[model samples]
Target: MTFSPDLTETLLRPLLRTDPHRPRLTWYGGEPAGRTELSTASLANWAAKTAGLLTDELGVAPGAGVRVLGLRSWQVLPAALGSWWAGLALDLSAAGAGFADAVFAAPDADPEVVAALVDESDPDTVLALSTHPLALPAGDLPPGARDYSIAVRAHADRFPGVPVEPTATVLQADGPLGGDAATVADVIERARALAAGWGAQPRVLAELGVTVRTTAELVAAAVAALAVDGSLVVVDPASGHAAGTVGADEQITVSHPF
Candidate 1:
């Protein structure tokens, strides 16, 4: 599955145009046998809304840096994709919050902890996600901080901004050797390579805390799955379900740690 240099053109737009109803991501975790699924259309919609929130409401401009915490949930997918859609540089490194223009964290994360990490940054720049299975809002956020699940809902379902530059830096991270920045072209190419290795339309199962660590890796994995018109089944290590059992149940064709 070869891809264009543009991330949106390669990974996102294609899915929306063809087979938009097909399930792209399926998550299994949370209390009381929780299961949630997002089709290609649904994922794209959320990404667009998130982009709208960043650009329209938060006043974050293109090429700005956005740091994301808590990578072990389905909500991270739309947020990561939306950042790219808005042409923001995503930093997934452990020490990214210091240099970020905005920070997104999980709902359960302590506000004080995130506040301490963001330091002098504006409290409004911090957005916390509920990670609700039904996409509910996270209520009772700290004063000045934004609720992602609530605020994002007010945005349009389609991004009304300019297309992202293919050469723009999309991700900043620590590569296998050292720190590196990946452009949209680089990410697309990496996704293509991953899809090639996974074979045609492979159903991949990955454990969030174990197999995946950073949101960048998860985004790459998602693009790989989408490139081949496949799907991703994500599970938390704490789900207490054996990988083999879940793989067999989900009919997963591949299982790899990201």
Candidate 2:
């Protein structure tokens, strides 16, 4: 159950080597946001492009925090991994998100809320995601906010990860259940533990709400799925698709439900 402490390398490099084209993520949502599947290579490419945006375009450095205010969709995976690719941390708190260097918001997020968050966090950059099935950029962004979908497309498809910092802070998931600042190695260790608990389960599904922001639920679920050589399925619970239906269709073996 040993794993690489470098989160980016642990998540992408091995998958790229072992089964690049194998399906890794499947997302199901409501109409116009149906089904989307990303292969290992596809997912890596997306993360790399996103990393390019963070590093080359936005000047995000290692140990910086990127606040993502979005639902559990296919895009979040790439966004999270991309942050890791740039050696950046993810701040998944429901509050105090404005303190991060950059912020990503979903379209469903209330404009007022986003504006307030921007005022509160006063981050240097804010990118609004349309969350379309086709991954289209938002046409009408809030003032001073850029469109993430459009910006990410201009980046390269591959990114050499930043130097590994196993002990560096990578996540902040302060919550009522229990929360702490975790390092890259700590996250990898937690993933391995979750994988061990899964035993022979083949696929891990994320059924938690976007509001349930926790490192264990967000990062660990995907890592554990990959640790077991299984795909991670992220579903929007309000997508008109039932959990049981998706589990049955997608061959889900385990779930981190709300």
Candidate 3:
């Protein structure tokens, strides 16, 4: 498969055309009930809805910043991809998240933390995910926040917009290692490099909290899998399952601490 340098072109379009029904992401939360699988077509649909939410409802323009707060979960997939679809820079670090144009938080996050975020960053929009296994609407949220599960349902499955420019910054992070940023082109290149050694159709296993600190790392892992016409299996340490166990169960071809 020819790899496109563009983030969306590389990650979504090609896979949708070639293998839309193939499972691209399978997340295990330690139990059968916690498992959530998304095929390329389904993932793209959610991403499109998320992009519509940001662009049409929130009025977030291309090149804006979107703060994403959450552990590694199935929810992060759409949030990351959707942000990219909308041409927004994804800020995975909490250091200056409040200053972003919008914020997306996990459903089970502490209310105090959410309140503090609202107070500190005072962003124009705050979206809280339900994180429901079935993608149901969340019950309640912090003041001034909207339920992403409900809001996103109203958006179309296909995003009605042009793809983002390759030079646009897609990810930003402030980690213990240091502050980092990458453009769309940079992300594609990094993903290609990461997958270069992995054989064809590599099924990559990556754990959140264990190996991934920023959403950018997860994105890279997913893109790498996509580039090879492969798949990504994500395990959250919080799920209480060992990475090796999940990797074995998924028959992963490669494991990377992205």
Q: Which candidate is the best by lDDT?
A: 3
Best candidate, TM-score-wise?
Answer: 1
TM accuracy, model 1: 0.87
> How far in Å is the alpha carbon of 127 misplaced in model 1?
1.0
Q: TM-score rank, highest first? A: 1, 2, 3
By the lDDT metric, which is better: model 2 or model 3? 3
Candidate models: Cα lDDT each: 0.73, 0.72, 0.74
Model 2 worst lDDT run, 10 consecutive residues: 210-219
Question: What TM-score does prediction 2 earn?
Answer: 0.86
lDDT of 2 at 233: 79
- Give lDDT tens digits, candidate 3, residues 1-258: 332233564578878887799999888773234778999999999988988989998899888988777654477778778887887888865565446777887754556767777876544478887655677775667787888888889999998444566556677755421246777666666667767888877888888766765655666677678767889888877767788988888898888734
Each model's backbone clash number: 0, 1, 0
Q: For candidate 1, give the lDDT.
A: 0.73
Candidate 1 displacement at residue 98 in angstroms: 2.7
Q: Model 1, 1-258: lDDT tens per residue?
A: 332233554576777787889888998865334678998888888888988888888889988998877665577888888887887888877666464777778754556767675566777788877655776776666556778888888888887444566567778765321247878767666666766777777898878767866665676677678767889988876756566778888899889824
Model 2, stretches more than 4 Å misplaced?
1-5, 110-113, 120-124, 175-178, 208-216
Candidate ranking (lDDT, best to worst): 3, 1, 2
In candidate 3, stretches whose alpha carbon ends up further than 4 angstroms from where it belongs are: 1-6, 30-33, 107-113, 120-124, 174-179
